[model samples]
Target: MGGYGSGRLHDGRVLCMGGPWVSAIAKDDRFVAGWVTHATRWGIVRGRGNSGGMGGLRMSYRRLYVPGATYFFTVVTYDRRPLFSDPVNVQLLREAFRRVKQHHPFTVEAIVVLPDHIHTLWTLPEGDADFSTRWRLIKTYVSRRCAKTYQPPGSASRQQKSERTVWQRRFWEHLIRNQRDFDNHVAYIHNNPVKHGLATTPEAWPHSSIHRSP
Candidate 1:
């Protein structure tokens, strides 16, 4: 009934329909404000969008329906600094997760907290949409609340103690292409302590989901 245009996303996936033409594929891309360059596990990528980005790479890799997938999402502290003196920050993070559930509707399969970052596995909710906005809102709220904590150098508000932004304002995400990737990232999150020479077994890590009783 309609026409379709396509392109390949940066991640090397073939994107067929760009816009409203497709019955399944999501939109193209969303924008983030004051975005800068940040390095991710994947490598150096643009952080301008902070969250709410739409790309074939994200939508593709397996158009996982919400509730069906096991996903990996992480939010790190500013410059990787560990400074969550307030438990409220953790609340904020969980609140964001809740809100994400409200919208994208995903079940958190796993979550782990490090001094400076977190890794969470989300199961997509059936018939739901993208989870990018969820991350965007969390980052935005945290950044706005913590703005004063770390004002961009040379900015006019550098003199003030505003939000005390605890996060780096951007994060890395993956769709968990398969079971292996899912297990790998989950193990990475759980066993981070051993890798960092902090603990021996992943179950010994207190900040991770592995420590919790199923």
Candidate 2:
């Protein structure tokens, strides 16, 4: 429900929401904080605010949920392992995306798969803004099938949660502000492989969506 805005909190810490995420700092004296609840499956965060806090502090920790928005993302493997160096793993990742898309129905605007990470742009359908669930499904698919092959050891926390050691627990996400931002991120995605010295040119990368671009 929260959306983008900027405001100064009582304690001089600025509260800002750029796209779908919000974070702020407040003085313990001026604000009475409540428990922070995290929806792990969807990666949505909801913060409870006490009655005594300033207006700006009430929702500073909540994520903005805007339907039909485009977002750019960076997903990395655990310990920076080059899991996608193998063609089989790359194919498996592709399958994961394909399967997730069929049910979730989001459009992938651009993507590039590197040895240890992936950069992608996606546009959600109108009346929906649930990219978190889509990502959760995609990551789960690849990890379940490829975890044994890679054999990376998960930490105690991950093992307790029955999570695989193939990927980092979190991914970076940014809502694309406009057409210019979209174009710039697409360029970044294509150029990522060359930046990492894995390819001579963006088009030379076999695992990139640049080949499909006009």
Q: Which of the numbered candidates is closest to the native, going by highest lDDT? A: 2
lDDT of 1: 0.51
Per-residue lDDT tens digits for candidate 1, residues 1-214, read 0122332222223333222222223233231111111223233332223342112133212222232334577767877676444566667666665665564555555677666777776654433335666667767666666556654556445336443444664565665543344456657778776776767887776666665444
Residue 2 in model 1: shift from native, Å?
40
TM-score of each: 0.56, 0.69
TM-score of 1: 0.56
Against the true structure, candidate 2 has what lDDT? Answer: 0.66
lDDT string, candidate 2, 79-136, tens digits: 8899999998899888988888788877776788889988887766656778778889
The per-model lDDT (C-alpha) reads 0.51, 0.66
- The runs of at least 3 residues in candidate 1 whose Cα sits more than 4 Å from the true structure, single-residue gaps closed, are 1-68, 150-153, 157-166
The C-alpha RMSD of each candidate to the native structure, in angstroms, is: 12.7, 11.4
